[model samples]
Target: MGHVPTRLLSHPCATRSPPMKERKAIESWLTDMDGVLVHEGEPVPGAPEFVNRMKESGKPFLILTNNSIYTPRDLQARLYRMGFDVDENSIWTAALATAQFLADQRPGGTAYVIGEAGLTTAMHAAGYILTEFEPDYVVLGETRTYSFEAITKAIRLISAGSRFICTNPDATGPSNEGLLPAAGSVAAMISQATGVKPYFVGKPNPMMMRSALNAIGAHSETTAMIGDRMDTDVLCGLEAGLETILVLTGISSRLESETYPYRPSRIINSVADLIDEI
Candidate 1:
């Protein structure tokens, strides 16, 4: 992560001038999980405080993640271990968003799922039957161990007329060993085989942001989106009509942000800086 320039704090988009009521309109928040809250299973500075403040303020908020390997309970426990007291209900995942999309599109449809517990559990909850034989869709999600056989099955299923859907567009994920191929990479392989591009239902896609907003019962115009990645979090937030805050605590840097056509509403060093605002 890079240092956020001080000038960015006073940028026009960073904060509304004068009328306190205008600033108070932003009562709810939607934040990316990995970069904004934690890194490598560790809590980012002041993340716990930020969350606690939101909870105490009686404002609705959600921790959003593109990673679909873990369920919300799983994430809650992980964050708890990192000393952040976030409830399971306060988390929104790509898995949940994808499942919601599927349920809305075809209410009781079957699907062949390729992912871990998070993805499977969401689909099952959404009333989607898991099957490999003539299913309605082929859903792809993040997993620690992606089997080649499963990929082959997904390719075949798509070729057999099943719609292709992916939880997120992240091509790689970090691990102790290094970077590993993630959901997007696997989706690419399947697309090459079946000549069908998957409809990604995660970050950088406004649908994901809208779903999260709905989960928290917050309207986009009155909510704030906090994230570290400009390409996904900031871009999606802007598209979803939410105020975007870019924190330089993960993949994006202050310098690189200038190159993007869309800019975040605010740029802070980390989630720590958000405590005073809350």
Candidate 2:
């Protein structure tokens, strides 16, 4: 990914403002998962309390993630193990957003998918059929293991007529071994083969943020997005017309974030700093 053009961010579809003078009290919260709350399966400092505060306040909130490999229930269980009592409904993934977008575009559509249970299950729940036969879409999502045969099939289907969709634009994912090839990497190969780039429905696209907001009946004016990355998290929040908070606990550093065309509404050390905000 490259630096976003300033004009593109200024499109009238959504509002992206410079740092605010005084803002409305945040009545709703949308926070990123990996960096803002947990990191490498462990809860970030003050993350659990922040989550508890959200729950206790009875305010609308959702934990967002680009990882489309695990279902919301699966993630909720994982968070519970780490002492964050987040409900499944309070978790949002790129898989859910992609599925929601597809369902809205073409109800009961058929798709050829290359992903794990998270993506497959969302597609199923959205009334989408999984097939190799003339699918309406060739959906790409995160998988623990990528199959050559599936990639070939996706390429062929896309070339033949299926529209291509990817869960996220992240080119790589973290692992115990360091980094691993992710959906975006595979999507690139498929796009190269078919000469058709995929439409991504994850962070930075604003669809993910908007879907979460809609799920909680949140209006942008009263909501705030807490994230750790300037690219995905902050961009998505800003485009969705939410106040954006950038934390330093993840991929983006204070210095690194300065390079982006737009700045987050505020920058803090971590979610710990926002506990009082709740």
**C-alpha RMSD for every candidate:** 7.9, 8.0
lDDT of 2 by residue, 48-72 (tens): 9999999999999999998899999
Which candidate achieves the best lDDT against the true structure?
2
Per-prediction tally of clashes: 0, 0
The sequence of per-residue lDDT tens digits that candidate 1 reaches over residues 168-208 is 99999999999999998988889988899999999999999
Q: In model 2, which runs have C-alpha deviations exceeding 4 angstroms? A: 1-21
Cα misplacement distance, residue 87 of candidate 2 (Å): 0.8
What is model 2's C-alpha RMSD?
8.0
Distance from true location, Cα of 135 in model 2, Å: 0.3
Clashing pairs in 2: none
